[model samples]
Target: MMKKTISLLLMLCVIRSFSQDTTQQIMPGRQNAIHQQDKPYVILISADGFRSDFAKKYQAKNLIALGEQGVVADYMQPSFPSLTFPNHYTIVTGLYPAHHGLVDNSFYDRKRQQTYGMQDKKMVADPYWYGGTPLWVLAEQQQMIAASFYWVASEAPIQQLPPTYHYFYNEKISIDQRIETVKEWLALPRDKRPHFISFYFPEVDHAAHSFGPDSKETAEAVQFVDESIGKLQKVAAASGLPVNFVFVADHGMAKVDQQNTIPYPTIDTALFTINSGSAVLQLYAKDKNSILPFYENLKKNAVDYDVYLKSTMPASLHYSTDDDRYNRIGDIILLARLPKVFNRGGRPTGPGKHGFDPHYPDMRASFQAWGPAFKKGLQIQGFENIHVYPLIAEILGLQYDATKIDGKLETLKKIINTK
Candidate 1:
């Protein structure tokens, strides 16, 4: 009898450990109150290249309503270079661009001498390229379901696992289709419902890159997205389910003209090359010594662009070099403050773009939150891109280290009910 009793105790201990691993941090928590919802959900929306000015200029009625009814951060300044992949990764991992990887829109790997662009999903989706626990992986590890639509890095595996559901960025699909897909998942049977959902709208970013951010075309795209959000609001209300809706932009946009471009040598020998559009260029260095001479040539001979060593990028940008992101970033980083045409093989490109420093107001992101959990009429200001990870962890009632992030949780506490 004594032997049998001891065996039973040992089995109980094993079962308890397994159960804890599956159940821990499943639902987010406030300091005092364990929110009494059946299972809380988050609908994260990324409005790519969305600037607060668009919100101010063309009336985003649905977003404004969401802001007034819920919570709005005055402005969320994006991380360095104000690029897409980096900020999107930061939003989930609570790490800066340096820590999380996805350093820039297009970067060159020094050791490999290859360039990686976000559009090339085949290469950019490697799990080894990223670090830290992305939110989707964190949810999955705790046994919760998560899904994403057209968000950056969604196609990549995190922690060797994919989100429960994901759409691998089909540009052919209309924005309406994207909204419907999100609604369909939310409409799933309670047992199959996704505990977290992320949605991305790319039309505005595309339009801004083609036209300019301040142009009417970009404004129209903003309105179109706002209308879609309005539809999402209707669906969520009719369902009467407990959910948190977060709307954030990867970065804002900037306008460039004839002045923004710079021409590389007319010959195509290809020591270094510019990829046109935003004056950013890629350099193929024969040796480390070539980097400085190349930068000097652009400054003295070209006279239109400014360049920097990827490793020694300006301090204010808060970016990292020699890591995953920097590997893709060109050996020499270029920004054109003055208007000029830039071309490596003398081929011209688009009229506008972004992905420069985040300090510029035009690069600041937009933020809005609405749900049962948030405080109505609460306003937060000066929130940075990295802070979003910790804030979302708070909403999910999960354990997170806010200190590991450049973003802060205290600023969001006013909107969340601690007790």
Candidate 2:
């Protein structure tokens, strides 16, 4: 069995995508709530840059065991523009970036002179840039306790309800310490313990950025995170917590050499400032005409990347849901094909990066669930990450307000088991 898993991973590595597609599909509509199971605690773990096959490729025993013992999907397709902040929030809000405002890892708000950037501590905490209610906030509003050790948007008070035990985003915090804190949280009495908790680990992502996704460093990073998961499992066992688990990744990494990139000067900088880069980039243009020079260049020249006016971006990406979305996304969007990366005025690419079109097979994220609320040993078809919110809401028995969300729980019925 291990040999077969390894063989499958090797094939996935070659294709840079995993998961077999199935014709089984479900369509649950908006503003609809699925039946909730009472009081089953949930722990959501987001391992950034964790490719669909990274666990099997590196022999992550604990995670593999959980998948074998629980409900597992072929994969989880990330929302389009498969960037970190956008997709992580998408998981919690059940809304695409078009509806929930974290349009990219970086975006600008003219009125507030605010920059919704991943690296900006202030911007990350500002509520104006975030839309919809994250799972933690919704859980808290329904008289249930919630917490986030390090999920995106956990640092802010979205819809004015912060998670009961939220922590500010700090990359310096070690994974061991984060797990220890969660162990303590889980050990609390049932009433005092958070009903919903989120944890994030960036070792895999950080290492993959420095060493290519195919490099030994990424494998080592995977092992490190896997061992951490082993420890977390032990802690959960010790606490005797009745928590369900959902392990996920914001998006998968694709290999691209840092040393080989097209010079940024090749694009006309005067017309638009490059707001993001790598497999995907968002452009904030000075004006619509300012974008024409490069628009014509991509059309006239055989370029490696695809360019689109925000309004004309492939409808499949769902980036331009409405006419007013342009202000958040800017006038143009750029997508880089695999093996090709954009160099933003000498911005270096590392061994790997994500933010590609989420539809690409390799760019798909990981999704596995185990415990009371999920079926055991069931491998179902992959679905969009947006549906996660409804699942979490159902587990907590949360009566959430879903004004701006796109996620629907009925579509994911195969994975959910009852109380």
**After aligning candidate 1 to the native by TM-score, how far in Å is the CA of 29 from where it should be?**
26
lDDT for each residue of candidate 1 in 243-318, tens digit (9 for 90 to 100): 7898899887767664435666432345565443353454555456667876777657656666677677776675
Q: Candidate 2: misplaced stretches above 4 Å?
A: 1-38, 257-259, 265-271, 289-294, 321-326, 346-348, 401-403
Clashes of each: 16, 1
lDDT by residue for model 2 over 98-133, one digit each (tens)?
A: 778778888776566555668666556668788778
TM-score of each: 0.82, 0.86
Candidate 2: TM-score?
A: 0.86
Candidate 1: 10-residue stretch with minimal lDDT: 23-32
* Model 2 / residue 164 / CA error / Å: 1.2
